[model samples]
Target: MSSELLPPNWPAMSIAEANAALAAPGSPVQVEDTVIDGVPSKGYTNAPPNIHSILFLAAMTHPERDYIVYKDERVTYKAMLRAVEHFAATLRDKYGITKGDRVAVIMRNYPQWPVAFYAALSLGAIATPMNSWWTGEELEYGLSFAGVKAAVVDPQIFERIHEHLGDLPDLKHVIIAREPGDEHNHPSVSSMEDAIGPANSWADLADIGMPDVEIGPDDDATIMYTSGTTGKPKGALATHRAVIANMFNSLTCTARMYLRKGEAVPEPDPNVTRATLMSIPFFHATGSFAILIPTALRGDKIVTMYKWDASEALPIIERERITSIGGVPAIAWQVLEHPDRDKYDLSSIEVVSYGGAPSAPELVSTIKRRLPNAAPGNGWGMTETCATVTLNIGEDYVNRPTSAGAPPSAVELKICDPDGKEMPAGEVGELWCKSPSNCKLYWNRPDATAETFRNGWVVTGDLARLDEEGFLFLVDRAKDMLIRGGENIYSIEVESALYDHPAVMDAAVVGIPHKVLGEEVGAVVQLKPGMSVTEDELRAHVANQLAAFKVPVEIHFMDQPLPRNANGKILKKELREQFTPRG
Candidate 1:
């Protein structure tokens, strides 16, 4: 190759190869379709499209690059792609995870999580990721709701499975990652490693060659459970086109804002290895569709964490030279406040993307101050939108820090009044989104499906406003709005102000019924470690900042942490349930 023809740091691969490095794995080339019982199944009528597209592209372009790192274990792109294929083959030939079959995965962030997830997806089986932190009751609800016939569970959660076993009568198999203490005594559970290892370490399946199984662009790819804020959690079905389209949109936005930002960003070289630290849970759409899929599609390295521990994450970021991070506000805050934070060389971090919940201004400012090399990007979406509907990118972020940015290329956004009439810019209303990434319907919940999805727009249950510049700002959950003495108060507004207090570690505001006022504001706050402040002082602090109606009439201090879901979202419903006086 002529020197002039290639840029100084250009990769060995040609531009076509570099471009292919980012392509999705098309339908599987040669794979057989297996049968699944009891599901109103859609046979593999389409070629192995999405998973095949991603795996093939990554293997061909960035074959030897690191794909995942879990503790001491590391797998390269070539090896990882093979593992996915091999496991997928095993599922088809050995197990019966066929098209449209519900295969659930219950594990924290680990190498096996993605392996099981994509393996199921490759077979045209609908992968369902349940929160690892879910109780037995919650797990039973999800298991039965998704019609989950089989599940890959971490051994740690074994007891929870046993608790719900009688209820999950349809469950045919339980694939455990670790070995059982005594095989005969362990019931129906079997070791996944033993089941798949004899076939070879999942890498051989990529090349073993099997008959082709067809899949469609619109076939179900994954089913993510809702936060269950309203009542019981419902599964939201995401098709291949929807998931892939979400990845494509995220890739485009990140390529411009995140991957291209710093001197350490390496000028988009196909050869310069990129790695990411996984902080988000595998069950959420933010983790699977947003972070993992995009990184895998790019053939970037992923370092897994069993759970987000700031002390452990900082070392990993410096050790891995992690280029990008995507997580909730809590993880970002934890990392920033880690004891040995300054010891780690976090200069390698370029983009610190955050979502899950609206970031506290203090946390946002803290990240910007501490990690000058990293910029905080916020996203807004739900399980229905496949993670990101609106993204705050580049200069728009500084101009409007509170805004969640504009809708991504793949999504359309609008704020509408209670009657579904479009609201003017800067006017608060229900935030609605329309996109291919939007779920087809709420699984088995026809009434919810109708209520949430109307005329192609998914009602997010979020109250928000779009600015003149098209930036979306979330106010709070519509259900969380407090109507006190004929005055409307958004809890988020009050909570954000409370967070500004140095003594405040966490804060949640809700409405309590009042005999005279109809309802009064009640604030629940947790103080920073070793910090102490009186309720009068806290109330005065807020009163000085916000309107009187928005100020808390009562304050409750807690020594314990706020109750949160797996994604780090405060479970206001639980708090309400706990605080409300029972007869």
Candidate 2:
């Protein structure tokens, strides 16, 4: 599909039309009100606010507040705005990165991430964030899929780009963020410092004479690639309004919870800025939408650590007085178990949100004991949902840790069986969501996109349930996959590589909980007749073909014929139950 098909001016129903549909019979309601009142109603009462308006507000209202704080470097909202203007003007003036083009940002969590993101958003260009951990082959697939023309990459990963040079011929510029002592010497790659240079080298944005690239609320803003149960990953294309609305929904949900708990919100005193201890990778939506975007829009201070180490994170959080943090379930586990956790005065941590994967109920109790004010909340959404649809707020989190909470105001969720029939309340079924916060479509995969985004809802491929009181709880995924350390691992993709091994007859991948990694991949396999394979050999075979995350942690060889049912299909559910621990 042409990128222009999902433009900013795409047809969308009015707010009134949306509200009526969401409030229609049998929809999930907010858990807070449901517990308080006898009657049921759709959770959100407000419309999804425009993100472009919020950007303008941040530029004007909190101009002087600290917007980004990397080690020894900080940029105020005013300064960041100017930086965005100059860089965006540079793109227009130098490379012609105009509306509808995709600009790729390939880096870990850093100040440059949001700078590049908002710069692209400012010019109506879509920001397609690639996983920093992705191999050259994976990066090539993503770059080609999105038709990305340019990339702003970290110097650390720039060395890996040569492997895919031939495949990415359309790629024009490589903007590398130079480190100290590196100097401007690379012949192939352009130095970003040499390009943007100290944030004030370019002409004033007003005098640049660039046309105002106007983008509507529904314009494509981000393309987040998520692993599919099928072989390849798919890029979920989210709109500008969708990304902003999800951020607002997250903030509103957090604010409401604090109010209900009788705790006064940390004043919207624009002077009281939030400092975030960011360890989550920017490739994921939780890092970009929940942590980075919200902080940038609020003119908050961000402390970014490129590598995620538990020991390093705790000290940084305490030293920075980090007030807010968001990460996967595994990250929370590390922080709670840090050796010197009690030594630090982590009292400033008001909110610690978790997403990417479901958390065990035990983690919630652990968080409460570690940080008194901290409430462990769940963020539930797929890439197609902009990584947030249902969020477990503070109050609901304190009350019901296992619940996925209520759907965001801009979102509408429904549970359906495999046959696409709506399931009754409390019955486990595939979860589907519709929202202005939802992605417009998948990039360049029409068949997959059509199957996932049906009728108006994105079929998340996750199995879940809506309780009688309207709280959503995840059961499993309709698609077979494992989430280890919050990174998604597709079973079929891994199994396909295993099946190619000369000694392997069959294989199945399943998730098993670990004390450290929230979940670990366990591979159950059967060797071909009269053939034998060592576990280490099999592991090495798959490791070469797949990324580290997709490599199985445990390998089990079965002697008897692999378990199968009538019609000769492997009964994976029985295998999962047979091997997975119950207690």
Candidate 3:
């Protein structure tokens, strides 16, 4: 794709023209209106009924295509599918994983995570991918809430679950991924090597076949958990329709970007497969449905990271010839700002994308200055919206670096005042969106679901103003949720955990700005009179219940009662101002 072909005034030309061009007949990306969940939403007409069918079709079509690249492991489409089939059969035949059963996955960016996820879905079971960073208590809560029947987890996670086995009575099977000859290491654990063979052992599973199960778009496909103000993680239920719609939304976006730039639609790469660096945790909606599933179906290779490291990433990009990288702003910033960033052959990168963190306007210019060959991309959405509703890419992205860009054709965005009255452009209010990408509900939390998802619109907690040009400018947030290194941390969740300690009478949490991680978690607490608690003690208390990332990096002890409003709610905005250092 040559930027020379793009008219100098092409961006001066209306964005509508580019969008319309993509929607035109015979265009690589096409759109049509359809009813989903009783809402007349726009969606890709050619999308599969469910993700299982799509992955199955891709495996049958491009059996030898490289699906995943992790360190020395290169799993082809056929290999992954066969593993999925073998595991799905084991889940059903051996473990009695019937329809609607919940199967859990707890692992880093290992190949088994996808294999476990698909296998669970392949048998009509709901897949629950708990955060790999979660503690035993957090994982137990998710498992118990979703009534997880079986889980395919790594040895480290298995060690955590082992402590809670007696607590989780419904959890029958614990399939642990162990090394060769490390089988039967635990009395209750089943070796993944024994169950599914060794890593990259594709030839051994040539005889396996996909499961014969009837799945519908409306069937529950996943129960991914998201944090809220209540501290407890709520499992957000999403049907196949929602996930598949998100997958298609990604594909269409790519097709449109190439077509609008007059670049030929991307075909299967011959020298190296269309590769991406996937360091984001697979449990996130952005990682699972948005990037992982779409990349898999296209037969693109995902270069996995065992854990995020900028130095480790540089070499993978050079050796693997990774064309696309990024799932978080921190990843991009770290890579470009690395002391030895220029020492590697980073010229292979064509696109860099991230979201969930508040991006500095200067970050945009930095990307352009350093990685001139790559176009920077960022989008907005949350777990409720399947992680992408609006994306700014290419020239449009560079022009309006601060704006979140317009919603895709399949997504509709609107602003509403507190009373639910719709607001016109330029008014800052709650951002409500309607799209097939919206998940169904907050698992088991009817009150939260009713208040958030209402009348065919997901009432996003983001406060934003839409310009007359249709670009969304986020002003603030309605919910006191802060993103730290792309992971969403609800202030109330941390506060509730702090209050759990008897020594703490009142507590408040706020976001402290950080140059690298976007924001760091900070806490203010007032202990009970005559009671003593050290910062380390309270921090350890919170860590036991929540993930380590959610633990406060900084803590302050307050002697007087924390500031409060007339309604008796703690004033967090005031705390952020008082506690936050002057920039």
Candidate 4:
């Protein structure tokens, strides 16, 4: 810890410096150009051997640090590691769960969720995190899709999926958490507390260490299911290499900021733990990649809310001294606009950021206004690219309010025309991104995988333009683009304009059927509480900012919030389905 050993001006290393260091020989995250699983892309020469290697490395460093926090219940890294060991051992010894076996973890944001996830991973099994918000039918599809061998669920989730349990042939084990005394007559069902008996308890298991499963970086790890807006949700299978690469990317970026601010990469302190409010469900990549994985690397405490409630979140932030808030754009909107915001002591918040949904430029400024000390950040990526490959923060973010910021050095983003030719800077076209953080494949759908994962690039559905400096401004999802007669309209362009209006709270623009024009612009808006506005007035508001064709041919208002999936992304397809276009 000598002063001269660190960066000259700052005790912390800059991202540029860190990047240089990473590229050097013997660096744990050092980079090299090579083909990974037939995809020519950037990859780590020193990527962690497996998921357990990464988790265990963290636990060994900060064993006593707080890992999970819910209400007054706190679980330390040591405790979590022990549980993971016990669960992994029990699954392997008692249940015959082994490598490549799929274990579905269906539950709310509880401490046991992570334990189950890591336990399965520790045994070289694929951890399938099914959407907690899914219905019985959806749950059945997921279990059947992954061929789930076992599932660690809670009582409430069991009730939702129990009806369809008979349909899943491969499901052999069910360890239900939170329902202590209840027992199931089903052969597979057992309470979580009863399963982790004294014979294979955490105390006994911690001494035995990880199982003898040798997992390589390219080995199967997570089968994260997509939102399935169009059809059945596709499971994006991420490798250990892909997941760990993302973790380093986040560290490099944050370290870059810390150095810029003349701060050091603080040593892991058990008492002085960094806290984040976990509002996003873990099923989403944003929750897993951007929040959960990165926080674990830093040994930071994650405080989970059973469900998203801005009121509940506010107190947790104040009491836990939560340093950052993120997940979805709606969470930020709700927090900054909450009527009872003044009642809580929310000064501890230092960062506010979100993605996975459309964001108005105004949401950024609103966050800065409410949390004066907090820096507002926004970025774009999808389930395919492991959440965030491009991230914009600080002055770069404030200056270019509309852009999804620039990609990290390890990631590449490009705009291409309809024919797949590269577009010049600032020209709008399909956005394609390539990175090691990109998932390996779409679980079992080879044809879909071939179509999307071409030549190491994720053929993102987003239509975007990149400035000369590489700031990406997302225009719309290519499929969502509307055509009115000969005129083309980007729904996001129109939605952003509507968001500029004072009364507009949440808005979505879609293309409705039109006999002559093929399709016409349509808007569904949820106004601020008690606010009223004419449809024509709102149309005029958009017309002022966009071309005439982009103005909504139809405007529908709603008394409630728009429909959203587990990730807080508005269900545009559902919105489009709600209306029958007139001739």
Best by lDDT: 4
The regions of model 2 sitting more than 4 angstroms off are: 1-53, 179-188, 198-211, 228-230, 255-267, 481-583
Higher-scoring candidate on lDDT, 1 or 2: 1
* Reference-based TM-score of each model: 0.85, 0.73, 0.80, 0.91
Candidate 2 lDDT, 1-583, residue by residue in tens: 2333132432243223333344444432221222101223223333233444554567678876776666666666666666676678767777789888899998777667776877787788889898887778778888888998878888766767756766787787667764421453533357666545543332233433223777766677888887432367788888776686676556555554544444554556755777888766767777787666777666777787767677777778888889876566546655765567788888998777776554555566666777878756786766776767767765466556667776545456789987889988988778888665667778888898889877667788777888775678776665565677778676656765776676665577787767677777778887655678898998999989988887877788887645542112355666776565422
TM-score of 1: 0.85
The full ranking of all candidates by TM-score, starting with the best, is 4, 1, 3, 2
Tell me the tens digit of each residue's lDDT in model 1 across 101-201: 99999987877788789778878899999999988888988989889977888877667877678778778778876554246264556767764552125
Count of clashes, each model: 18, 0, 0, 0
Q: How far is candidate 3 from the true structure (C-alpha RMSD, Å)?
A: 10.9
State which candidate, 1 or 4, has the greater TM-score. Answer: 4
Model 3, runs deviating above 4 Å: 1-7, 24-28, 179-188, 228-230, 258-272, 481-583
lDDT of 3 by residue, 1-583 (tens): 2355245755533556556666666654567877777777776667678888877887877789888878888888888888888888888888899989999998888888888999899889999998887789988899999999998898788778788988998898888864532564654567666768866895468657778889888889999887432378778899888898776666555555555566666775544557888867888888888778888667677888887778899989999988888865546766876677889999989888887644555566667778888888877878887777777777666667777777766777899999989999999788999988888898889998999888679998888889886788776566667788899786656765786776765677888888778888899887655689999999999999899999998789988767642112356776777555422
Q: What Cα-based lDDT does every candidate model obtain?
A: 0.73, 0.67, 0.78, 0.79
| TM-score computed on alpha carbons, candidate 4 | 0.91
- Candidate with top TM-score is 4
lDDT of 4 by residue, 63-177 (tens): 8777888776687777777777877888898889999999999998888888888889888899999999888898999999889999999888899877787888899888887
Which regions of candidate 1 are displaced past 4 Å?
1-49, 180-188, 198-206, 209-211, 255-267, 527-534, 577-583
Q: RMSD in Å for candidate 1, one decimal?
A: 8.2
